[model samples]
Target: MQAPINIALVGNPNSGKSSLFNALTGLNQKVSNFPGVTVDKKTGTAQIVPGLTANIIDLPGTYSLYPKSADEYVTYDVLINPDNADIPDLIIIVADASNLKRNLLFCSQIIDLKIPVIIGLTMMDIARKKGVEIDLDGLERELGVPVVSINPRKSKGVAELKKIIDLAARGNYSAAPRDFINNGALAKPVTDEIKKAVPGKSDYAALHIAVNADELHFLNIPQKAAIKQTLQTHQFNKTKVQAEEIMQRYNRIKHIMKSTVVETDPLQKQLRSEKIDDLLLHRFWGYVILLVVMFLLFQSIFWLASYPMDWIEGGFGQLSGWLTSVLPDNKITDVFVNGILAGISGFAVFIPQIMILFGLITILEDTGYMARISFLTDRLMRQVGLNGKSVMPLISGVACAVPAIMATRTIENKKERLITILVTPLMSCSARLPIYTMMIALVIPDRRIFGILGLQGLIMMGLYLLGFFMAIFIAAIMKLFVKIREKSYFIMELPVYRAPRWKNVGTTMVEKAKIFVTDAGKVIVVISVILWFLASYGPSSRMQPLHDKYEKMIAAVPADSPAADSLDKAFRSEKLSHSYAGILGHAIEPAIRPLGFDWKIGIALITSFAAREVFVGTMATLYSVGENPDDNNATLREKMAAAKWPDGRPVYTLAAGLSLMIFYSFAMQCMSTLAIVKRETKSWKMPLIQLVYMTALAYICSLIIFNIFK
Candidate 1:
């Protein structure tokens, strides 16, 4: 029997670490939060060979062992702390072969930690494309550790890497034969004292403990105090010591590279990607290109997805009709057909748009244009008291606020990160896309703009841009009030532009659509069923009188006559108006009447508090419940268009539809988002304040819009 060993995949950000993890582990992976932090920890089981299995943990990337952001420190602790549950039994350092010198700095630091190490080199192809060549054997001999050049994307060198890992595990689990730098001599007294505090580790590990003791979670109060006392006693200077160590490591690496690598000539000329960036990164044209790209994106959502959306709507309508006719006429049948089927159709019809949105976003990320977007927006982000790093989260917020807020872990500045979180939900997430789409269809005419652009899509783009600008505007206001001061810099490396990874894009599309179905579907179904019950039945005192009146009216006419059908219709509508759900909606009607919302709209507004997407299902179930049995084939849009108030005005007029869209845009209606905000900020106070301010803002905006349009 062999014990399973923990193997950590570590590297700088975008250094092919995650790609390698996926290559080895395949589908045997799950993500969970790291201990005491919101950062995701991806772990999987890898069958290294027939009989050998390893636990692979993909740690957050860092440029060095030093701690900076919350997520970066998670990597630091797992590697440096001896008692960490996730401390790797063996570390596979994934380094980019193209950027060997810069990559080696972190690699050498890890080598000196004396953990059993293997250098899994990546990006050899990229290096060769730049006219750089490497002698693998010479580099292996120089570093005194095995160096395996791997192309994780192609699954190249993985078998050999696994054999080496297995051999290393079976053998001594040895560290590098020689120290990359003489850590003991860097600061003899401080290193020796730290050795006592965290005993039996190498000098490099001891030095790290001395520098990072305060940030290390594994250290107790006494251990920290002792380390601090020792540093004070020895007059230790972290900056000087670290600076000297880095210089020494790089100096040694320079000698190693001279013999083992042939570098590209500096005057050889710019790479293809650099040439392409000339236009993509241009100040004037770049902005124009970005706008054109966005306009096309929104247009595609309508143009390409319209056919599939229509098919889904038609399929669901037919399915509902068949079930209604085949099932026995009873309360249970009505609930299933109207409550469950209607709710499912409401969101299911929007799956194509959701998929298109996420798929396009994934393409932007895959093609490397996403990073340039941050670069382009950096100057503007600075104007709002944020750095370019905040731009990623804001852009990601278009998919969902939970992940977008989580993405703030990458923003190092506390004030900027907090402001980013507070304003991110203002960006219209895909959940709101459903609302926007429905409203656009309901109110906006389906005509072309500038003879080509679809009016529906153009309006949709305005909503997204409106949300983005509003986020920026709110962030600027929060900047003045937050009052946290910290220095931060945004240094981004633009990856060479590559063709979109179509496979990754497809996976993301399926995954995102699945999430919409499973997560949003559950909420929509539950709300729909509950609304059906409330709308279907009323109190006995209110219902009995109506039933008696309708029964006599029905007796006055033939059962199959058109007059009899009309009386049944009047009975159902009157019955719904007096139902419990109707009573509740009327109760809140006065408060929302200024926004052109009636009791039915009020019911939707209340039920959809669980989620913004639930509004669609709420309307579906509400409209489906009281309709004539024979007219069940009418689509929701058609039904809503024909809906009228007691005074004979349309319920979803241009004024009302616009007002609803405005409310959903600014309202903090998603409980899941608020929960994540609370988790990220670790305070109910911030999310609570956010909820109050956003809801108030939504109400005011909707009020003003309704008044103007009415």
Candidate 2:
């Protein structure tokens, strides 16, 4: 049997490469990191025919073989390294038909490598709408390569593309014309030396090795040194050679296009998208619209998700009650119900809000407005020691900081990228939503000040904006201290606006929800089990005394009486106060008391070091354990509202509630985020410094807020 076919899907950014990849391998894809870098590598398997299976790799997008950022470098490295284990047997180049000229520049370079190349044309509909027409057969003849026009969204031409791929993998296909560029006499010496150093490599590939030998991972110290020596000996000008090669390729492409393609008179009129952008990208109005859009986003997160959130909360409460009734009253049942189930329910109830958050974000991205946001924020980002590319990661940080920090890989400037990573977590993520929501409900009045905007939502928006501004402020300060000097600029193409891809949006929503559940859920479960062990079993001396006191109190009150209910709560609270979890909380209480937090709040602060969302789960387990069994149906908000200190003052007062909100808003409570930071920066020093600074900031902010409100 023939070896499984390996196909690499390559494209410029936003060239619809990912759409084609999704079309071919719908549910068969897996994401992994590249060999020595953290950039993601996506690979999937597709059945080309009944008996032929193909391994398809979706390479990171690049505008040219010459790379800029880490992502683009990954693509270039994979293509030039012949010994790469995952190198393709066949290369499918996806190009946007609407933007053929710029897209073909990269395609031309790839073709000269003498690989079996197939052109998978995408966005033909967009091209036709712009009055651009192509003579497919004529173009195919000119380039001596097979061209298949496809609409990956509609799954059109995919079958033919698969057949072409299968044939190419088996060496049953013809190679593209390999003379796109003339290697001038000046380049002959350097190219010839590169060929001798690396046999079987095409002249174009060998030329690349000569120019970028230092950056190539496949070359060892001796190989790189030898190539450098040869280039120096020949007095080769790498830049001049590359520029001339590009001009030659484009010159040939120009004549081929004259015969094989018909384009619209672009000077005649502006596109519909450009006309729309006139208002959307306007200086003043654009900022206004942006603010309105963000306001609506936060409002929706509160209003739209409320009903489903309530249903989840009530349903879990009922489920907990039923489990309590069926299971025998014992330690095992207690742990299962209050420890494991309670923890799951805490995060499970917030899934609806999380879904809405990511769903809206996906829609924004699919419609092409997300790029414009980067464009709009570019000037402001510059003020904060970042480039326009930093805007994407900061905006994405609202959904989750791990992916946001990962997104910083696109920023080419080292100092700017590091500053962006250091401050990105300041943008309140969805994990903090649960804390913000609960605290706002506890303290903020539910009245609308502007007649249309709910006060709760407005407060939520304030928190979001507060976090964003704080990020910028912090980034500005970091700019002063980080002494690295590097030139930074932002260059991005704004794709034409299109209708949102509902299928892609839905897929993203499901995938994000799955990530949140699986990743955050794992941490929650372990912390919950440990918390239960600590909260349930205290010192034996303390445990025996509590048991004796509760037993006598129960004997004094009639069953199901008000007095019995009161005594039960007292007994449970006292037991928890002496337990190991409570002991830990008490140990830190003095340090946090100035911020209006008690021993219970201290417990939450400690557990939440695992993750910000775990604060809610910690509260759920603690409150559920202390409640009367008959009152299991009470929502957490109601339970916390009724909680009082030993001195009888309400625990969640205006001062303390505001203080808690302020703390969470500023604190760096997520271990996962810190891990991602460490990975991104390649140093524990940055994360450690970040942790100390943010925690200190949170304490000061909370302290000031509590005093002002009190």
Candidate 3:
């Protein structure tokens, strides 16, 4: 049996590492957590040769091996700890060819581990376009490794890269080490100490790590006594001494590049991207442009999704009506149509909005605008006791709070990250859209505010803004209580802008949609079925007698009586629904009575916890029960408008609708979100806290709204 070779893919952020991993492994990848940690671990297998399989692990992106955050720690630990279960037999250091200087910092560290390393130079097309020419043979000689230029997006050079991996695994390729130590006599003692500490480790890499101890914690030394003694004898601080050695290595790299690399145009460095970035990164217009971009993003969510949402709603309504006509009037039919089918369709109705939101985000990220957003938002974030990196999680909260919370792992400071996670759920997610749309349509007038902002649109925007501002406010308050001493910095690479990759955007949309439908869909289907059964059968013995009595009264009424037809329909529908099950619904009706909700609305709320959008479908299903075949006003909106309370008051008064919207906006109603939070946080405490806080807030807020309106 052939032994499977372990290969680790490492790179800086946005170096096309993920794209390369996807191309190499395809669907053979599995994402899990590192042992005892919530950090993501993505591993896959690629056939490196005719019979040998290579297990490829995509390590988290980091600038250096010295980790400050939980996610970064995983990468640092995996690389240095040989006792790790997935220790790589070979290391592939992926570098962005466009930014060689910064990329090389990581490569230099990896090389010091004395492992066989190959360089996968990504984005060579970008480098070529900028009039940069790399001497591959010279680079290989200087780095003591084979360098392969790959455009993973285009599937270029991947096969050759794989072949190189196979050869490296078989110990078939070796390059002579470049001379990095020019002052070997002066640094001999320190280098010897490092070699003794880590047996067989590269002297050059150890020297670099020892010098830059403050910047990146490469060495696991508990005390600096030995290094101090060496440094004192040499009259240098160990940190500065290590930095000087790294500079020596870089000087040699620069010398080699001067000989082998060429620039066709001297002014090619001042490119169009640089010119555009000057404006986009400017202090004033940069912020204005960011605001405008965000405004447009939110506007697109409502305006663009409106037509598709209507289509989904209409299509589902028609389907439900058709099912009612086709299926026999039996318990099973009722469960299938009213419970399972209706529930699934209800959740499916929100796919267009979710897809559009995800697609836009993916596009922004691909074009490097997300990093810009992080940079722009950093100052404001720092004011609220969060590092600039916190912006990533906050923005992610707009799509789903669970991943947003998980993304907080990138924030190095523990207190700041915890506070960010605690408040992220306040951001208006796509899940809240159905509730917002339904309630706004029902309550807020369709007119403009001051002849400028649409009233409904303004309210919607206010809700999102409220959530955002509240998150910051809460974080600020939490900052005063939590004690933290770690220093935070915002040193992020701003990649050159590029056109969005449609393939990546499309794949993201499909994947998110699949997760939503499958995970949330199951819970919704079960709930809807239970609700259908509850609403369908009653104490039929008592119900039948009461219904018969009403029927006879209608029969005994004078044929010419003006109220005969209307009275008979009302009496029959009521008696049929008012059986034992109906009595139970009525019993709970009074509990929700304070919020201007009837038992039916209570049922909708209960079922909608599976997903907020299911509220519309639940209402549609409930109101359609026992209706005649020719009933007009087929839309939920139309039916809701015509619905009346027992006292002849409107069931959907402006007060009730506003209260409902408030309730949905604040409720922790998504089971999938809860599950994801549990998975990401690695405990149920945080999610349980979220559930309690959100539910209480929703109830209190809705209660206040209903009472004030009443």
Against the true structure, whose lDDT is highest?
1
Q: Residue by residue across 153-182, what tens digits does model 1's lDDT show?
A: 788999999999999889854888788889
Instruction: Find the 10 residues in a row with the least total lDDT in model 2.
Output: 177-186
What's the lDDT of the predicted structure labeled candidate 2?
0.87
Q: Write out the backbone clash pairs for model 1.
A: none
Q: Evaluate model 3: give its lDDT.
A: 0.75
Q: Estimate each model's TM-score.
A: 0.96, 0.96, 0.81
> How high is the CA lDDT of each candidate model?
0.89, 0.87, 0.75
> Distance (Å) between predicted and true CA of 95, model 3?
0.9
**lDDT score for residue 7 of model 1:** 97
Residue-wise lDDT of candidate 3 within 1-710, one digit each (tens)?
46998888999988989989888887688778889776779999987778789899999999876666777778776776556888788888899987777787778767766677899999887788778888888887777888998988788999899899878867886433543344444367776775666565566545644564444443455435565556567665655655675677587667766876787866676766678878888899998887667666666666788798889878877877787787787877767766676677667777877888889889998888888888887888889788888888888888887677778888867777777877788788877876777677777777865675566766777777767777787678778877656878877878788888787788888887887787666766676666666666677676777768777877887865866766656764685367443666577887778878877788777767777666766775676554443352266676778778877888898899878877776778777678877776678997898789878877888899999997
Output the lDDT of residue 367, model 3.
86
Worst 10 residues of 1 by lDDT: 263-272
Models ranked on lDDT? 1, 2, 3
Residue-by-residue lDDT tens digits, candidate 2, 617-697 = 999888888777767777788889999888999889889988998899889999989999999999999999999989998
